[model samples]
Target: MKLGPIDWAIMATYFVFVLGIGFALRRYMKTTTDFFQSGRSIPAWVAGLAFISANLGAQEVMGMAASGAKYGIMTSHFYWIGAIPAMVFLAVFMMPFYYGSRARSVPEYLKLRFDEKTRGLNAITFALMTVLSSGISMYAMGLLLNLLLGWSFDVSIWLCALIVLLYITMGGLTSAIYNEVLQFFMIVFGFLPLVLLGLHDVGGWAGLKTGLEHVAVSNGFAAGAWSQSWAHMGSPTDNPMGVEWFGMAMGLGFVLSFGYWCTDFLTIQRAMASESMSAARRAPLIAAFPKMMFPFLVILPGMLAIVLHQRLGAGGFSLPTKADGTLNYDMTVPLMLSHYFPQGMLGVGITALIASFMAGMAGNVTAFNTVFTYDIYQAYIRKGAPDAHYLWVGRVATVAGISASVAAAYLATHFNNIMDMLQLVFAFVNAPLFATFLLGMFWKRTTGHAAFIGLISGTVGAAIHHGLTLPLGSVPGIKGGWLGLTHQYTSEMAQNFWTAIWAWSTCFVVTILVSLVTKARAEAELKGLVYSLTERLKSDAEAWWRRPAVLGVIVLALTLVLNIVFL
Candidate 1:
């Protein structure tokens, strides 16, 4: 995993180009809107690439590989189950709401729709989540750098963070998108050959099937592995993966996708900046195809790596094990590349991996800047601040947010699993907001009082449920555990998952019930804010609907095909 001079050159060149792009575009980012929201001037293709790139971080690549190494094709559900559907739904149902309303931030929409308090609470919640989420993204990139190049984790974290900060501080989202487009192409071109080579190394498709089945039967993996039937996509306990089929699909496909694609600001920022509403709607759809192939590029290689690992004997590319004798799943991708990739190709893949980290950290920093500036600083401290001061504050916040996230990365250095931590964080933070936002969008009766109550109550409810599952003994049945929760508890992921669901349900139901008792906004007040679901866009925007029925049918067909193929 050592880097040669070539690797260093590539990395340096990448950073220099990124910074230059930011400086070159400095003139374009004149106003506060330009600095934070790209002046709403981004083209559809640019927005589309940035949308996908924001989600394609080092954690995602490594996490998918880890899942594949541990669980086989089952990991594909991360996109098939959740990401694809949520994005499609958003495009058809939600994009119109966001683009048509022309709100600067999503939380701003809450204020226009409901009341100021709703906007304030959302702003606070979203700002906090942005910081924490950015931290997790940074930590994952650092983890990747440490594993691939044998660098110190802290040094790697700082190195990645500083480079991203330089460009993002100068160019804002404009530079972020510009660099993302370049990285996206680099990643695809750089890593795809490895996948093709992997299939070759493992022999043909038939040989891969033979290798997979032989290991499945000989190692006493579940009978499902050898069965052509895809009924049980999840690995059994005896297999390397600890979860079942139902768990993987539902977790990745349903919960994670909805949270990341539908709600996360990092990805949404690009869509918000589209040149026109139609262009914005097309951005997410353009992203879906690439997203669907993520598992193919990232996950399948890891699974193949596992097959190669066992064939080479236990001594080859050995990973440090925990007391439970489990292979450190985080190391799966690195170990595989070290073992199987050709020496020359290994260097290319390593460089691409590093590019993945850069892309990820840059995206996080940009999103953090947007939320901190628009949602927190401008909204609260400087409601009437001049454009120049606001831009200065954005630059300052970019640096500050990056620094804070880097600190969080250092804190997360001790955690073993990035996906688990990410999922748990979203469970508490994302679930309630989804309900609140959806209610505000669709229901005319929902009041500011109801929205505030739902937002606070749902978040608090999640905290309580989170506490109960922890080993803190703070609640009688709970024990202290990971992330300052219950210790050594069973099914903590499942517990957190269901707790989040309950939180969302409670918030939605309570918000609705409360609205029933509260006063409603008058017709005049609500006129501009509300839109019918069937509202038609003008001709200019209608072109963005290029083949909606076609896209819907394709998505539904793919969904059913995956479910049937892997059922």
Candidate 2:
């Protein structure tokens, strides 16, 4: 597909606006705190929007649309069941210890509440994860650009990396945060029209459902299987996702969602940048409102793509297929843009995707730099450094992070399945983290030694489980069963859910058992860091709507309605 002059103009304007913001904020990045933490001066609304945009990356946009095509409305569970509750929990229950304790990063919080070794382990793993995630974002953006416009993948990756690095290195966290707020608007505007136009061509919601009904029947499912979320979740084989209620609810809703939304440093860093404890608490809650409604914006397009080719025939675009002829579901959204958008609107759509790429890549890079500079470098390599020196190191780390991501992007081109393998690594690394944080913050008796040991045990248990089990019709390799195929799963999603459950359970049980035998820290030292040790803060003075708990309740109620309506 070729772009018109109008399209190039819109794309050029976005690049200029982002760079302008970076240069605009250059003066404020003098101190290490300013560079790393946005000087802790961001208002709640700004922080809140940044929090949402930071996570609205390639995975959320492209990956979700892909899943929506494959799994139907059951994919909404990622938002309704998996994300909203955890984000609310973060704002209402967990933000106090994180914000009150003055810990700069999540791993730093582990150090404050647990011990150095626990913090060190978390910092290294998190740092590596960020690099890998950023790299994948690059690959996604590059691949999509290449497919859509025949752009050089190498040039696309480097040019985008250069832009992210320039803005982040110059304006620091403040620039990235503010730019993220802008990107959020671009993404929403870009995709909203696409959803509307796609729905129109499919003859609105009712007609779209009829088309999907045909698809569901063709795929050997019940008529409503592709249109409803919970109706087909009774058994693995009943739904397109091949995941049962127990595994979906416990594994995704409880473990993976909480593990990511609550504990991961990427989202938490945005909340941490808020100016006050109240603002910090409100940030994620503010993010929850949009998050609850995102399925309509992101997921529906994939659903539309499912039957568009059948509707429009020669005029429509179908998803690209892999070597084995399986549809490359990730291409669903980009191809939809090419199919439905006009010349000028097409530019806006492409720019929106680029915004998502930036948000994902920049979020990971900023978080990676902060963690490396404070938790890794300062604590281990160089201690008691002057403020100016660390600030310089932070700028240096930003460049290094971008370079590492670029390298990973090139590595991705050579190995098509590398991302699937990396997901396994992230599963083991991230699945056990919430248990460590949960016990460390809420249970004062939890020992540092136990937190460290439990993390290892959790990751090991996840690997062992994956090794012993294989999803049906898969070979014993990256997909698992290297040890022996003792059990089988109907789908990879089910396998992932079970892996998370086992990881979380192993970590939780091991942490408690070891903490029972090990020594606990003094209660005085735990103040402000442990939940019970600290005084409970309140939003009672604020209006009912502004209160975090109240907002959380409202968000959850709306999500419940959506699930039921779709079901």
Off-target runs (Cα >4 Å) in candidate 2 are 312-315, 416-419
Instruction: Give one digit per residue, the lDDT tens place, for model 1 in 1-567.
Output: 565676566666766787799889888888878888888899978888889887887677778887676667756766777688888876666777777775777777777788878887767766656666677777776666665666787887787788788888778888899888888887787678867877787776666567666657666776446323245433434443444455445544455466567767778888888888777777887777787777778887776766665576632444447678866767766666666665655666676677777777777777767767776787777888778998898899889988888777776776635535554554566667777767776777779999899877887777676764552124433321323443322344445555656677778889999999999887566654555433565544344346444565576677678667655
Name the best candidate (by lDDT).
Answer: 2
Tens digits of per-residue lDDT for model 2 on 1-567?
789999999999999999999999998888988998999999999999999999999678988999888878888999999999999999988999899997999999999999999999999989988998899889988988887899999899999999999999999999889989999999899999999988888889998899899889989999999999999989999988889999999999999999999999998999999999989999998898888889999999999888775555643667777999887788888888888888999999999999889888999999999999999999999999899999999999999999999988888889868877886787798999988888888899999999999999999999999999988889999989999988899998899999999999999999999999999999999999988899988678998887888888888898888888998
Q: Provide the overall lDDT of each model, using Cα atoms, as 2-decimal numbers.
A: 0.70, 0.91
Give the residue spans of candidate 1 off by over 4 A.
Answer: 214-221, 225-230, 233-256, 313-320, 342-344, 413-426, 464-493, 527-534, 538-549
Q: Positional deviation of 138 in candidate 2, in angstroms?
A: 1.1
The local distance difference test score of model 1 is: 0.70
Clashing pairs in 2: none
Q: Which one is best on TM-score?
A: 2
